[model samples]
Each structure stands twice: as structure tokens, then as C-alpha cells.
Target: MNPTDLSLDDLDRAEAEIETGKRGMRFDQIGSFEPNAPSFLIQDVLERDSQAGVIGDSGSGKTFAVLSLAACIATGKPFAGHSVAHSGPVLYAAGEGRAGLVRRFHAWAKANGVDPLNVPLYLADRGAGLIDADQIAELRAAVRKVAQLHGVPVILIVDTWARALSGADENSAADAGQAIAVLDELRREYGGMTTLVIHHLGAADKTRGRGSTALKAALDSEFLVARNQSSTILLTATKTKDGPTPAPMAFELEDVFLKTLEDGRKVSSAWARPVEYVAESRPAGKNQSVALEVLKQLYAAQKQTLDGAGFAGREALVLVSDWRQACEAAGLDRRRFSEVKASLVDSGKVFLEGPHALLDADAVSGAASESGGTIVPPGRRTHSAMSEIGVSDAFGHFGQNPKGGR
Candidate 1:
């Protein structure tokens, strides 16, 4: 066949054929790639161009937590003190609780001191049936319009995978897998927007959602939201394909008055607010605190430096020499502090990559910690790989920091 000889229809047909069949690319056929860190939507919580799920038991505040995240992303604000790498329109498909969802959204936005009416957050009250091709088309159209208006990619959040799959059998692996495929199709059709689906935990096990293992296996990130004994809402990332699992972030509900009925009864709803950071519960030896402070300062500085170069998505690397200087500045012995690097990495506060120690993606950078001046101890560990390491009321400064020219 002559190159540049095919008609448009002929090329389309050829492409359709390839799409309809199983396809594989040989290793050699794949071209070389420059290593770039994955871009995140909610910094450590969710990555861009990815599909994720939030699974929790009933009344676990799964919906509230997810909406809180969506609100942050829509406003380019911080969520639970973690940075939002980028912000844009958020399309929320309210499948199960439309009325309550609205009140919760208002409460969350107001509680966070964000103006809901101004942000690019849209809600689809049509309920699930998103698995249906017609409904998917409608959603894509709506998202496209919103994305165009906002000049940014849309984040589509489908609340409750079970409701979205309305008629499908949740226990049937084939049915669940097919539903996921439909969601993936919607993701691709959007030309690379994020799709986050809310889900429920399995009846017997409290781990992942109720579905075929393939659902969890296919996700780029999986989160588990639950309430601790203290009644604090904890959001933990259980699985992350491209990045390290982030430490748990806690939220405490705050009440927002909705209205007063004619009968003089007060109507109010509560939404989650990030708990203030408390210094690590475990006592840090005098030298250890100094050592950790040194690393924290360096990481924050590196992160700020990278954000200037349009490479903030990549890990911030602090050189060993820099660490030594920080230790000296913090009045700690450089040699004794050398072991602190290993300790930080072991404790999941940092990562050692090549000659540099990269700040863990969710680690509160020194600048943020310094500004907040508090840190909570790591959350208790579970069988799952993730746990809370620190807490901070690092909100408010998001979107206020001046951006450097890239």
C-alpha cells in the first residue's frame, strides 16, 4: 500500500479494526521515554488521567470525604492539608443521594470557607445508569461543555459504582468487569480526564469494595475511608500504582445551618474539616527532632524550587550535602544525623532515590509544617500498606502562594 494514499474512511476503518481486536505492542516497538513523575489531581490522593475508587462501609462518610476532595480540586485548594497539583471543573454524578448530597456540598464548601457558587463544580442528578451508552454520551457532552467553559480538563466523579451499574450483578465478576470497561471507555473518550467512582466495602471483609478483584486490580488508586474510635474521619490510600501510599489525613465534622422550618425547628448539616496538626505523638529525641527538621526544611525548599520549573509533579530531591548543611544549621551533628536519613525513609517520611532523598509525596514539607507548626504521630498501622504519619492544618495558603513563571 502506498503511504499517504488512504482515504479518511479507509483510515477510520483500519483504526476501528485494530480497536476491535486484542492488541499488543512488542517491547522493541515501544519507544524510549523520559521519566516524568505522575501528575496528581489531589496531590497524593488521586492522579490525573486515572480511575480510582473510594470504598467504605455505610455511614463511613465516604460521600462526604469524596465531595470534600472534589471541592478542593475544583477550587485549586488544599484537601486535608495536602496540596492540589492542579484544579479544574469537577463533574459529580450524584447517583444515590441527590438531595443530601446538595446539602453536604453546601456545608462542605461553606465550612471550608470556599464559595461554592463560583467554583467549577457541576452536579449530575440523573443517577447511575451511567453504565448505559446513552447516559455515558450525555455525561461526556456535559463534561465537555464544562471543560470548555473553564478551560481545564474535567474531573468526573461517579458516586457509587453499584448504583452506576444499576442492573448489573455486583458479585458476578464478568458483570462487574464489564461495568469497569464502560467506565474506562468514558475515561478515554474524555481525552484524558480523571474518573473517580465511589464504592462500598465487601460484606465479610472490610478491605476493598464489594466486587470482582478486577475492580481493585484495575484502579490506579484505591482509598478506604473509615471512622476511628475518636470519631475522627480518616482518609487513607490503600493502593497506588505510580506513587507511594500517602499517610492518612483526618477530618472532623463541623456543623452548617441549612434553614429553619416554619415549625421553628433548626435544620443543619455537618461537613468534614481538617483537624489541626499535632506534633508526632511519639516523643522525638532532642537530636531526632533536629535531624527530622533539617530534612523537612530541605524538602520544602526543594519542592518550592521545583514548582518554579514546572516540574512540581516530580519528587523534590534534597542532596546529601544539603542535608548535612541543614543538620548543621539546626545545631545537630552532621555525622550522627546521617543515620536519620535511613530512619526517615524507614518511617515513610522520605524516599532515597539515587544520590538524593526525595520527600515522600504526601510528607508535609518543612515550609508547610513550619507554617502550621504541628505534626501528629503516624496513624496506627493495619494489614493494609498505608497509615497516617502526620497531620497539619496546612489549609488557607493554597492558591495564595505566588506561582513562578514556568
Candidate 2:
């Protein structure tokens, strides 16, 4: 057994045998791909090891949405009316701002009448810093220990992949891929415990994550949050491996806090409004024409620069009222103003600037504006009129007439 006496061939044979022995004892078949397993909707298959990527543009409520999901799971409450299959201890690795997270979690728990401290929840005491492989290993060990002590499986929530990954530049595809691979291995090692990694959407494509394609390619499921239709936050399932796609859910943030009951219990709560998303439709005939007038007025009021980023101070109600008044004055149905605004927005005639809807600034102010801002209201234009004059041609004519004469 003397190491110095062993030949090179002998050492190679011995190493190979050791590896074979290790493989024989390993559970390599646990996650082997199966083609015939029944595919269930994400809502249907509730208990399984899964990983999901929740991404969004800044201020799109990605964090809040995921926090809401975590809260729902923690309380065994339905998430956006979707059923919950399991309620267990959860671990939130808040690497961003601890104080903020504390406040948020407290608010969520209080609002839901759940005790923040009593829940099987754990926060990493590790201070703010880059997470390396050592930290990842430490997290794995800590999670296992917590699960064993609490007798409940842990859902590890890493706030942002950029902060959680150690020694890997999140912006670099190669580095991110390697780092994510490590995370995936950790998830596999844990026998499929749920691991949710919050990440940022890229500036170019708000739907795509910031890192390499590999990040999205390797994930089991993915969710994208964005402002859709109205000011409501839209949560869409972009990818799913073993379940049906979850329909896009909308929500609005109301408030945040922690509350102490009349008794001695402390709970976290978050005031949120669930938004209903309806398909946009144009009003009929004269109502559509009035809607056009209202949009024109709003555009004229703003000097014609309208985009989602503008309209910061106005309320949607106020804008709707203004539209109603303009429609009434034009002898159009005031009741259809909201529908008209929604239609214009959907049609791209009116741009959503945050909460306010107004005509597109570039479109109306540039060559399109040459028609003196005149636009045929939806539903009012006859098929013959539409066939005689296209939108661009009509706008061109309007542009030529600064006064917008018929």
C-alpha cells in the first residue's frame, strides 16, 4: 500500500475504481428525464423541487410580486386566486437592503394577520457583500440545518442573482452560466427544494434577463413582470418545464407595515389592490369620434409629447373626466370615454405616460402633426372613408391644413 511503490498504471486503476464505487452509491437517476410524466398546470403541481426566475424592469414590482408570492406560500393562502399546495418554512436571502426587507416582510405579515416571527422564515445574517462559492456552500449548509431543526423544507429566496453570485460577474455570460450551474447543482443536491432567484430584465429587452441566454435556458420556470394595459403590474409566466403556464396576474401596491393585534400577536401586512385587466375596445360611431377629440385635447394641452414616462402627476380618473367632458361637448357619448381612451391606448394613438394617456408626442408633433392634430375617431370612420384615405394619408392632409378644415 506504499504510495511511492505504486506504478502509474496502478494509481490510475485505483482512482478509476474509487470513482466507480462513488458512482455506484450516487442517486443519479433521481432527476433523469422522463417523457411520459403527466404535465400539470403550475397551479396543479404544488409540491416539487422547482426553480423560477422572476424578472422585470426597475419599479415594475418584481420584488413585491415575489414577496407577495412568498407571503402567500408562507400563509397557505391562494396566490392571485391560484391554489397553494404547500405551506412551509421559507428562507429569504436578502442581500440588497436588510432594513427595507424587514419593513416589507413586517408589513406583509401584519396585513395578512400572520405572525412575522412565528412563520418558518429565516434571513441570512451575512452582511451585504458578493456571494462566492463558499457563501453558496454556507447557505446550503444553513438551509439544511434550518430544515432539519424546524422539520420543514425551506424555500431559499435569493433577492437578486447579481448580489447572490460569488466570484462570477453577473454581466458576463460565461461567468453567469458557471455560477448558475453551481446553483442548479445545489438545487439538485437538495432533492428539488424550491429555489427562486430574483433577477433584473435587460434594458434592451425587458422580457429577457440581464445575463446570458444560458441563464434563461437552464431555468425550470420563469416569470416576467411589466406594466401592461393600465398601470397594473402584469406577472406572466414566460417559461415552464413541468407545469402549465400561469396566466398573467395584475396587482397594485397600496401600502406597507407591521401590525400588533389587540392581543399580544404581531403580524405583517401589505395593502395591495388586485387589478382587473380587460381587453381594450373602441367605442361605436360618434363616441369613437369624441374619443379622438378628447385625445387631441390632451395632446394639445401637453404640447404633444406623450409617452409612458410622462404624465407623472395627473390621475387616471381626472383624465377620464376630462375625456368625458370633451366628448359631451362634442355631442358624443360621454359614457364611452373610458372605453375610447382604452381603445386609443391599445391602438397606439394615445400613449400611456405612467398613469396618464395622451397622444404620442413624436407622432403628433412631427410630420403626423402636420394635419393639425386631426384624427378620425375610431368607429366614426366608414369603410369607404378608410378605403379612400389611409391613416397616414389623412394625417398628411390634416398636417397640410394647420387649422384642420374638412
Point to the candidate with the largest TM-score.
1
Write down the lDDT that model 1 would get. 0.67
What TM-score goes with each of the models?
0.62, 0.58
1-406, model 1: which lDDT tens digit per residue? 3568889998788778778784423455335767688888877678888988888889888887888889888898898888988888788887777888888888887776777789788888576465567876776676667767776565788888888778777777777777777778767766558888899988755645887777787888888787755667767666767665577677778889977899999878888888853322334577767766656665555445445555535444456555655565556665666556544543445444323444443455345454333222223212232211111111122222212211
Q: Once superposed on the true structure, which residue ranges of model 1 sit more than 4 Å away at CA?
A: 1-31, 261-263, 276-406
What is the Å distance of residue 276 in model 1 from its true position? Answer: 5.1
Q: How many backbone collisions does model 1 have?
A: 4
Model 2 agreement with the true structure over 1-406: per-residue lDDT tens digits: 4569999998788788878785324456756966555322225433357666887877787877877777777667777777766677777777777776677677777767787777766777762133465676777687778878975553667788777665567767777666666666656776646777888877554446786777777777777776654566767655655434344577877675465789988755344455664433434355565566545544443332321324323221114344444455455554555566545544445543212334443434432353233332322212221111112222321333212222
